[model samples]
Target: MLPDISVVLTTYNQGKFIKKAIDSILSQSFNNFELIIVDDGSIDDTKRKIDQYSDSRIKKVFKQNEGPSSASNVGISLAKGAWIALMSGDDISLPDRLQVQYEFANSFNYKICFGLPIIIDDEDNIIPDEDFPVFFSDHSFSNRKVFKRLFEKGNYFCAPTAFFQKDIIEEKNPFLISSLQLQDFACWLSLSKKYDMPIINKRLIKYRRHANNISSKNNNGRMEFEMKMIYKNILNNMTWELLHEIFPNQFSVASMNDKRCFEIEKSFLLLKQSIKSVHEVGCEKIWNYINDDVMCSILSTKYNFNYLDFFMETGKFNTNERDESND
Candidate 1:
């Protein structure tokens, strides 16, 4: 009989941490799950480490070094369970993580769900002040309007914490092969456009931050470029007429760079509007990500202007200061 959940873990040269990752799953409180490990052409002793595992439920697939997206796609194709759980070789899932997420998904009839993760160092020690600012956090998106707005700002969910029904992937194949370094973010964005992504408040995974992590290797320019492409792709899929209707001034801009900045600003406004419409609190939290300087700077440089000046002229900073002063 097929398992209730299929856990897909993709590893490349993560030999040191791979064993811990696998052991975490094998020791999960949830027993009715199959663990699928895809080794993406690791030149290290990753294969030897995997070979040491003889769990009957563990399925190992060895493949060429294509990247995480391709490896995950292969695992998705092999999944036979009713639900699929995403994992990374360097992360540790709490024993109750799968059980909690699985129950939450079924109990609420949610197609996709994710939980918060505790940040850990290379030594598996929890970071004392892991409360660093992020785009989205601790809140759940139960509607398309709010989800789209949140996604437009940035990816807020931990990929390794994602737990969802298998049919969602089999039907849509939301993971994009082109999103080499950001397949999980792209996938979440695509799915959030159509489904509600509720969050389980508990921290289910120990997210390891290490030097060898894929995100750690990305330069600022490449990260910004990839993000721009993701946003552009999402916008392009919408009807041109609709996009113009939503962002008339942005569409009227002559320069492509200027247009991108305008669109980003428009997204920021829409996100605020959506938040105000749905939740009374946490609007300020959303703004933190929307008004991020690094993102604004990237857009400004691409569009040939001082984004700081734009912020000042638009009274974005002054308004926030005024609000805080009043408080």
Candidate 2:
């Protein structure tokens, strides 16, 4: 019989924490979930450790060296459950996690659900308040507008805490196979375009941070550049959407190239003149394009335009030059 949920726990060389991760899932209060562990060519003893688990619900697949994106896609393709939960081999799920999420998803009929995670060290000890990163404090997943703004600023959800229906995974092709560093972020952005990913509001997973983690290895300037690229793609899409809504007649007649070359002056004027209408259309508190300096820098550096010009042109802010300051 198929299970109610399929928990896809992807691992690289997390042999030290693999057993605990699997144990946490097996001990979940919600029992009808299959645990599929996809080992992405770990050079360590991760496979041997997984073999020690005799639980009939645990399904292990050993694949050749591939990144987490590919490994996750493999597990997703094999998932037979109605709901799919993503976890990392180094993370620990709270006992009531699956149950709470399952009920929440069913109650709201939401296709995607995610929650905040408690940061833990390699030794499984919770990090101190000062040391713990405050990632999602300002974001509200329940508010679609707030969530979209948060996503534009940066990825706020932890991948291991995400739970969604299998249909989203199949329909969206959620993970970008080529993205090595920000694949989860890319997936979340893709899903947000068409679905509402509500936050569970409870901490349901222990996210382990260690030296060997993929994120730790790639947390450099280049990662920021890649993230900016992702944000630009999202911005371009939003711009087109805004234009299509505000200038329906012109948008309908414009060629693709003409649309791309369309002056930001017109877009800015439309936004300034119809801010209320834009907000009513669900883009409440659109900050990134207006006030975010980092986003402005990305726009200036890549698209070769000064974002502050809009503020100056609209007399919104008394500034002569683009404020190059970033938060």
State TM-scores per candidate: 0.72, 0.73
Per model, state how many residue pairs clash: 0, 0
Task: Give stretches of model 2 more than 4 Å off.
Answer: 129-133, 170-173, 211-218, 235-327
What's model 1's lDDT at 311?
46
Candidate 1 to truth, TM: 0.72
Top candidate on TM-score is 2
lDDT of 1 by residue, 1-327 (tens): 899999999999999899999999999999999999999999999999999988899999999998888888899899989999999998999999999998999988899888888888888887753343352344656545434545444567778998988887744346776666556776776777568887788889998877454333244334444554565455435543444554455454433345445454444434343222111122332344347886556545554445354443344332222110000
Please provide, for model 2 over 1-327, each residue's C-alpha lDDT reduced to its tens digit, 9 standing for 90 to 100: 899999999999989999889999999999899999999999999999999988899889999987888899989988989999999999999999999999999998889888878888998888764554444554455444543544434566778998999887644356777667678877776776667777777889998888454334235434544554554454444555454543454343333344323433334333443222221112222234445676455447545656465444445433232221011
Alpha-carbon local distance difference test for all models:
0.69, 0.69
